[model samples]
Target: MKYIKIRIPKATVYFTPVEIEKLLNKNIEITNKLLTQQTEIFKEGLKRGKCFIRSSKQKIREERKI
Candidate 1:
């Protein structure tokens, strides 16, 4: 199979291409763990950035209203 699907927490839809699997000797566990960790970090950073932007915009709108 060129691609393999893994079922992991917040990583159920992850697909590893054969090239990477071969590089890791067909060990998908490490790949999934690394991917999930990276995904979590990215999501957290995005959430924090978006929340800050939204709050700033809301403050601007409120200032205009008053």
Candidate 2:
């Protein structure tokens, strides 16, 4: 048997803010800080993926030239 590992990049999702103050009082609502941190995480992961793709393309080009 062979195993393959793959990583899929996730795009940022748009979530509607509930206007009710009662919903805001619950722990289930995401805090602004947490949302900011999650956004940064997504940005970083996508950035890394983009760099990896560029590097791989460069390597392939170099190999073809040789």
RMSD of each: 11.9, 19.4
Models 1 onward score TM values of 0.51, 0.55
lDDT of 2 by residue, 1-66 (tens): 333333457644333344333556664456877888999999999999999999999999999999
Most accurate candidate by TM-score:
2
Over 1-66, each residue of candidate 1 has an lDDT whose tens digit, in order, gives 445667778666545685655767646777888999999999999999999999999999999999
Best by lDDT: 1
Summing lDDT over every window of 10 consecutive residues in candidate 1, give the lowest-scoring window: 12-21
After superposing candidate 1 on the true structure, give the runs of residues whose Cα lies further than 4 Å from its correct spot. 1-28
RMSD of 2: 19.4
For candidate 2, the per-residue lDDT at 52 reads: 100
The whole-model C-alpha lDDT of candidate 2 against the native structure comes to: 0.72
Clash counts for the predictions, in order: 0, 0
Q: How close is candidate 1 to the true structure, as a TM-score?
A: 0.51
